[model samples]
Target: MADVEDVQVVVAHQERATVRVGEVFLKIDADQRRTDVEVEAMARAPIPTPQVLWRKPPVLALAGLPGSALGRLGEPPTSSPKAWSAAGAAVRTLHDAAPPPWPGRTLDEVASSLERECTWLLANDVLPADLVTRNRRIAEAALRPWTPVFMHGDLQVAHVFVDGDRVTGVVDWSEAGPGDGLYDLASLTLGHREHLGDVIAGYGAEVEVDVIRAWWSWRSLIAVRWLVEHGFDPAAPGCEVDVLRSQV
Candidate 1:
């Protein structure tokens, strides 16, 4: 093992933080349940994930994946379409497996949170009234019934790693559990609309394009306030705000 001489903060907030030391990542969380879920889900997932180095209460250490992340929110993906498709295929495999024993938020919970976030966004004047309203209407399409499948929960393009056209692994398992499959897909393609067709082509199944678009609106609408509070910029070019605007 390498010595921890140089440390880099991967991500940090009040709730949790992750730092990298050599090839190891130490994730410190405010909540243990999320860590528990992450461990179990990684152990159970059929696809590749970071190797668990060790766990000690608030900290869980994992080995880094071999390649770079699939893409970034505001940047064009340099990876080939085949790599994106491979990511979709890996997600399909994860979805097909049995779900984790713990449950995810129900539809009502999701709807309630969506309503609150939407209200906050409007009240704070975070975006134009028309932009919020149009996207809110589009979001309604995602509120309908959905069959539960094992979901990565936060399938950000940055979370999926790849080498050439091969998907090495996915990281960030704290949000993993049973949920709508399209939510993962929508999350991956949220700010990268041009890659949707490639991902769907890799998905290799019949999925409603409208439903994906709906989730896109719903995801972007609910994420603005949180991103701002967490020191992130959702309004940046090719980010969540742009995703919402594209819906119009």
Candidate 2:
């Protein structure tokens, strides 16, 4: 509470906004339940996470991690293969740990949303119908049942932080819970397929890579309209649109 001069707005949407004041990040959320889940999940996760400084209803303060993000959706990774491997290892650790008390999306729920989103895409002509159709077919493989594990339900690459070859911590834990582990894997490597092997190498190779690819399609396909609504460009190079196109 000293003389805080600089205030940086990190991200803002209708649902939430994150502002950074000095080294502390203040997350203002609309839903108290999501914030509750985030705090609890971070406490439960075996892997590194941000330190919770305080919480005041809509605003939660977290101490910033020590490293840059692993990468962004439409950007080339600055972290090395070793760092990506480290991230994968950390994810594996989280998956092996006992899950939280809360629930995550079921397979049926995911499939239903995919169907609705696909219909919206078609109606709006958001993408070429054939492209949508083809990726939808590819995405079908991910619709099957999975053994649940503790999932960082939105494991985007930007949420992971690293320094050199070491994973410093992960952030944005509102979506963490029991869910498909491969979904987490797919999310972390989305738009960054080249690093998948390095991740698998560290994670130990019981994974079905084709399933990972399928989830990639599924995730990208369902995400397009949401991105558009959220003022993000899914069609950006190396982003969600490119990810869907790369299915073949």
Clash pairs (backbone) in predicted model 1: none
TM-score of each: 0.97, 0.97
Question: Candidate 2 has which clashing residue pairs, if any?
Answer: none
For candidate 1, the clash count comes to 0
lDDT of 2 by residue, 1-248 (tens): 46756999999878899999888999999999999999999999999999999999989999999989999999988889999899889999999999887778898998998899999999999999999999999899999999889999999999999988999999999998899899899999999999999888878758999889999999999899888998888999999999988886
Q: What's the TM for model 2?
A: 0.97
lDDT of each: 0.91, 0.92
Q: Please write out the lDDT profile of model 1 over residues 107-167, one tens digit for every residue.
A: 9988897899889988989899899989998888889888899999999999999999999
Q: Count the backbone clashes (under 3 Å) in each candidate.
A: 0, 0
CA lDDT, candidate 2, residue 85 = 91
